[model samples]
Target: MSAPPDQGHVLVWQEPVQEAWIDYNGHLSEPYYVLVFGHATDNVMDAVGIGPDYREANDASLYTVEAHVRYLDEVSAGADLEVRSTVVGATGKLLWIWHEMWVDGRLRATEEILGVHVVGGGSAPFPDDIAARARELLVDPPEEASGRIRPLRRA
Candidate 1:
């Protein structure tokens, strides 16, 4: 499927591995992978204007309902990694995102995330405006992965 015209707005976050993130094998620790992806998700949310302030103003925030990650390569400590994210799809209360982590132009990992907007006071539906904004950022799933689209599998 083709990417959305405003795909340039998709966020890219670059981070370098720290000593603390390294394991005895001299590679990034397993847990750090999730941590890094979490940071990348924050960057994407900020780019779409649904960041901290927006959540406070609207009394709503995005929550990760599920995430599927595939580690393709090892990234050693001190390696610089780039994370690129795109909104694969979005509905009234759900969002599907794809993230790729690359180190020195080589793919290291890929993550498919499912999220939802919930009211700050409770787990309720998001307001109309927030839902509309999310829809605008949604895009068609990649052609090869078209059949993979499905409801999130909560971790």
Candidate 2:
């Protein structure tokens, strides 16, 4: 199948680094990287009708199965950063998403996340309605929006 549209529409979430999130090196800690990305994922899910309410109604939830993040720069304590995410790919119950951390329009990091649909506790196939909603939001980065990084690849 052909790739989805590279619309490059960035969903911006703003937050400042708290004292607890700082590391010995005087920057946001490594674990918080996933935390910020997780927040971004939740935003994207809400946009696509897969938020907590949807899960509660459908008896399904999306869980991250794998996440790969590359830290290109350091974010200092008290610094405000924005986390942006886009849907890269989706099929069956799996979704491949890409996220970036930005400070003042400069990219600080990039993350590739793989999420799976789950029911109760185990892996479960995506229902038709949810799949359709996700497909509607599946997006590709436009050439101008891609910047220096390549498009997200499937796992």
Candidate 1 per-residue C-alpha lDDT over 10-129 given as tens digits, one digit per residue, 9 for 90 to 100: 667778888999999999988888888888887767655678998888887779887888888999878987887877777667777788888998989878787787776556654666
TM-score of 2: 0.80
TM-score of every prediction relative to native: 0.82, 0.80
The C-alpha lDDT values of all candidates are 0.73, 0.73
Per residue, candidate 2 scores C-alpha lDDT tens digits across 39-148 of 88877777666788888987877898777788989998888878777777777778777788888778898787778888888888777776776777666743433333
lDDT of 2: 0.73
Candidate 2 clash pair list: 5-140, 6-140, 6-141, 6-142
Scored against the true structure, residue 119 in model 1 reaches a CA lDDT of 78
Poorest stretch of ten by lDDT in candidate 2? 1-10
Q: Model 1 scores what on Cα lDDT?
A: 0.73
- How accurate locally is residue 44 in candidate 1, as Cα lDDT from 0 to 100? 69
